[model samples]
Target: MRPSDRVTLEDVARAAGVSRATASRVVRGDTGVTAKKTKAVQAAVASLGYIPNSAARALVSRRTGTVAVVIPEPDQMIFSDPFLTQTVQEISRDLDEADIQLVMVFGDQSGHGRRAAKYLRNGSVDGAIVISHHRFSGQVEAIMSVQIPVVFIGRPVAQASPNSWVDLDNVSAGRLAAERLLECGARRPAIITGSLDMVAAHDRLRGFREVLGRVGIDPVLLEGAFTAESGRAAGEALAPRIESGEIDGVFASSDLMALAALEAWRDRGLRVPDDVRLVSCDNGPEAAAANPPLTSVDNPTDILGRAATDMLRAILDETWDGQPVLVPARLLVRQSC
Candidate 1:
């Protein structure tokens, strides 16, 4: 047949000597058709070059077969952050298997919550999966008000009541990081935390502090954005204290910051794990590939993404009862600590 000649299900049904309904069932892999008839329909479909109209089928099914993934950050940041990249890839894979389309929406950090709210209210997609909820500005309320299913990647700070979220056990991750450093016999451990306004960072810090306090060690705390630049600045700021022998160990809340601290230590000609033991969060590839490697906390981002997608799917399917899912974190030991 010519490339311009389009094939339809009806043509396949005629060639297979079966009703169009039976041909469709065969094509869709629906059960109940006899094996012989199914094989005949399949052969006819192959010979006729029959291609199902997915869009038309969706229209008839009242399902767009699409899910919206909302990221509250600039495109550049999204691409730079390994955690976000892993989460997105996992979510996309899960959605692909379910035959659902993933529509990505990038929102401005400043006033992103309101913008996200407005975007969802417009009803452009079936449901939404929200990431980076720290920048959320009443967006949760807006999302909940939309009467559409929404699942959050991390714990939302603004909302006092726990909403449906898929997150790592950041508090336990923090405790583990501190414990690992202490087990190495490093004293006077200090922590450089991500934005405390976010619950993940806060919980991690709280956990670290609790463990350190139990051991009678009070850690010096500093706050920084989750970026290499901020990590560098944090390193410089903490240099004097390290030199004065007041700080012997350090824990960075993110891998980016940990890398910066490692560089800062190198620049000052200080021996890692000897002079200042360091541990970081997020065991991304970069963390494992860093010079001397980094002792880091490993959060299952792929699993978290899958869980988030499942939660959103449940809500959309009206099978969820609004429960938060918490995934665990593991500690990976390496040369840095």
Candidate 2:
């Protein structure tokens, strides 16, 4: 084809000596094709410089070949968190590998999530992969109202019937943290929790408390907003107790919060692992950057992202059987513990 001339699937089919249907199937990356025909179509495509028309393909296939990765947080919060960035990047890569496009949507508290839900409902994309949707976000309701498939990166706080989710087993993570603290002989342990509105926070706390309860120990629980400020406040609140030999270990729900806790302890002249051992979740970059490298739970967030995308793809392809998938979490020990 000459410059400014578009190469069509018909031209590719003719060049490969195959029917247009076969050429289209190859272009769509469908299965059940003979190796011989596949090679011929690919070779013809390379020789003819054929670039598939996305609009025309969508019209013929009734699929937009795109998916959305929705984060129900403000743009700043979404971008600032390293975990979210990683999740988006991994999801994009996985979708791209499947010959699909990724559309990122930052769903702010100010109705941005609902707007995104509307866009999804309008057939703008095939499916969506939503992350960190809280009970109060109202995005869940909007998502449930839409016909398109949605796969959540983390378990949504509220249940919308017949939804698919891919998440690390938060309950297992909590249980493991509790076991580690116990094994380390940490008495009078406490927890600085993430936002209670999030299901993850609830699951982790439940598992932590359940394990502690079995040992006849009740942990001191403090509410936190999953922010450094909240972590600092909780740390300050517990500092007095820690100093008096009352609380000796802590599990903060996030690495950022754990780092802030370290700061509060330092201000009070308390040293980590020496004075009070610590473990946290979401083993992000901050875990290693702390003065003493923090022990944290690796939630396999990238795997969660990949699983969510794959689930959405299956649903879009009418192959998913409506089962939820849970990836595992593990503890990475460091000086903080």
Provide the overall lDDT of each model, using Cα atoms, as 2-decimal numbers: 0.85, 0.85
Model 2 per-residue lDDT tens digits across residues 1-337: 5778888899999999999999989988899889999999999999988998988878888998888888877676687667788888898888888888888877666673677777788877888888888777566877766788888877775545455988888998888888888888897999999889888888999989999999899999998877778999999999999999999999998887888889999999999999998999988877977889988999776788788888988887799988999878799988888
| Window of ten residues with lowest summed lDDT in model 1 | 135-144
Model 1 lDDT tens row, 1-337: 5778899888889999999999999987778999999999999988878888988987775567788888877777699878888999999999999888998878556774677767776757788898876645665565556656778898776555447888999999999999998998877989999887678889999999999999798899989877788898999888888888999899999998989888987899877877888999999999999987999999778889899989888887778877899888899999989
lDDT of 2 at 212: 93
lDDT of 1 at 82: 83
lDDT of 1 at 179: 96
Error of 1 at 197 (Å): 1.7
lDDT of 2 at 292: 94
Best by TM-score: 2
- lDDT (Cα, 0-100) at 309 in candidate 1: 89
